[model samples]
Target chain A: MHEASIAASLIEIVIDTAEKNKAEKVTKVFVKIGRLAAIEIDSLEFAYDAIKEEYEIIKDSEIIIEDVPITGKCQKCGVTDTYEEMFFACGACGAFEVELLTGEELTITEIEVD
Target chain B: MGMVDVKAKILEKNYSKAAVLRDKFKNTCVLNFVSSPGSGKTSILEKVLVMFKDKYKLAVVEGDQQTTNDADRIEATGVTAYQVNTGRACHLEATDVEKAMAELGYDLDLLIIENVGNLVCPSQFDLGEDAKVIVLSTTEGDDKPIKYPVMFRVGSSFIINKTDLLPYVEFDVDKCIGYAKGVNPELEVFQASCKTGEGLEEIAAYIEGMIAKKKNA
Candidate 1:
């Protein structure tokens, strides 16, 4: 799955940050993954756990992922609504011109290290 | 233990590589074609690409889990083709495209990257394409756009292929477009049937417009 590749990239960033801070060990990696990113949380966790074992610094580190919901603002009505599906029609105006406000993030926000 | 602020995109490395490739492709119109397996991606290329090969410098990078069959088919049409066998990967990465370009070279009017036939993974990976042209055949459910919204949301154009079977199938074109537009209102839609050569001219004209825009830019 692509989650493995994503995990590899996440580890690269984690290791780079840990090394830059001269940390001896990493304990936790905090990440934000949006619903629209189409990532499976369990798969990502599985991949992260499997890949983390390859590095000594982050060998025991746990990945903490925050799942973000899809939210958008209607362009015509200026109404904000959380989208359950991919459809983004404005709930108030019934217009298709809705601007997405979130649900596409794939960021590593912080890490806890010693 | 202390907390360190990282605040980095996970695919930052791939994004940076894609940015480089985008910069290098200033004079080339790169189109990343993506869709589910057996959605007639290579077939569309085999048919539509032939129209442009004689007039412009064009090449294709075919990505698959195995076999160079697609590349061979493209090569048979007289356009240059390179095959990238990912072995286990479900999608093509920016690095894979970079390697393909090394052999295909950067001097060209158009470069079409036929991504691995998975609707899920390729949407996350950018290969320096100017736009992602998504194909959905009528044989598949018309609600595919809603099912695979990430691909539809990120795509610039939507091609409803295998329209020749519309009479035999229950694919509702209007509902499909409505769903797609609900996710992405700006998607340029096209209907095509490779068997009948329907809608090939419009697609070719779209590609020509992209090439001209890139060349003039």
Candidate 2:
């Protein structure tokens, strides 16, 4: 669901940033997405390819997506820990009730243009 | 080939627009309603409109991806209701709501948008609502909060409808409260049935109270 939206936006952001930096073309786009960001990477790449086809600067662009783990705070023990979605429980007290913290990021980690 | 590593989230456009809408709603206090397909959201709205339409100046935006069924029901209450069909999207976006407001074509005291029948996609998209009320039924079961934690955690209020069917189905009211409290301790929960009119007064009173607070503020 998010792949199409994410890919379309990614291309726009890259082209905009590349223009701002006065670059002729963008070769690699590095994006850091969190575990709970709800994006499908494979579909995102496919959509990116389709969208980039019209962009002269990003026709051969490479997208490297990295997954950031999610952090949660336990209500029972006040323990803060990091875990994937499948293991979304308090690591210290084994409580299923936990407050999500910091795993919902969709950030542009870096941009390389030359 | 020259390489440009760009890192950014695509939802920045949608999320930021929602934030601006939230700030605007803080001054007016709009209540958003979300529920399953057959959970009686429009029926409850129709009943409430009957009792309070004369007491208040009301405008309603009915959000359905396909039809104007809910808006048609609210219109019979002698109130002007705008129907917004989201087309293929599962939920109403802040931009969609902004258009609905323009199409309403009048002054208003209270506006309610009954979102699409979904607990997932709708929860993620914000319509600049001051408070969100989620409707669940006795038939939907007690484990709803556990299964759909996203909606339960985000909603400001909960309406457990279909109280008249208590004898026919197995719904543990205590368990639903317990699970919801475990996730969000401050969530205000209410129980009512648009069918029997049981426990409906409390919700109507709550809505009136909220409207009064907004006007005073």
Candidate 1 residue-wise lDDT at B207: 89
How well does candidate 1 reproduce the true complex, by DockQ?
0.92
For every model shown, the clashing-pair count is 0, 9
**What interface Cα RMSD is found for model 2?**
4.1
**Best model number under TM-score:** 1
Candidate with maximal lDDT: 1
Give the per-residue lDDT digits (tens) of candidate 2, residues B103-157. Answer: 7733566778899888766766667777889999999999887667667767888
Model 2 misplacement above 4 A? A1-11, A32-56, A74-77, A83-99, B1-9, B19-27
Per-prediction DockQ: 0.92, 0.40
Candidate 2 structure quality by residue, lDDT tens digits, A15-114: 8888988988777888877655555568777888889999898787788877767788888899988764333457788776777877667777666776
**Alpha carbon lDDT at A112, candidate 1:** 99
lDDT of 1 by residue, A10-76 (tens): 9999999999999999999999999999799999999999988899999999999999999999889
- Candidate 1, residue A110: the lDDT equals 99
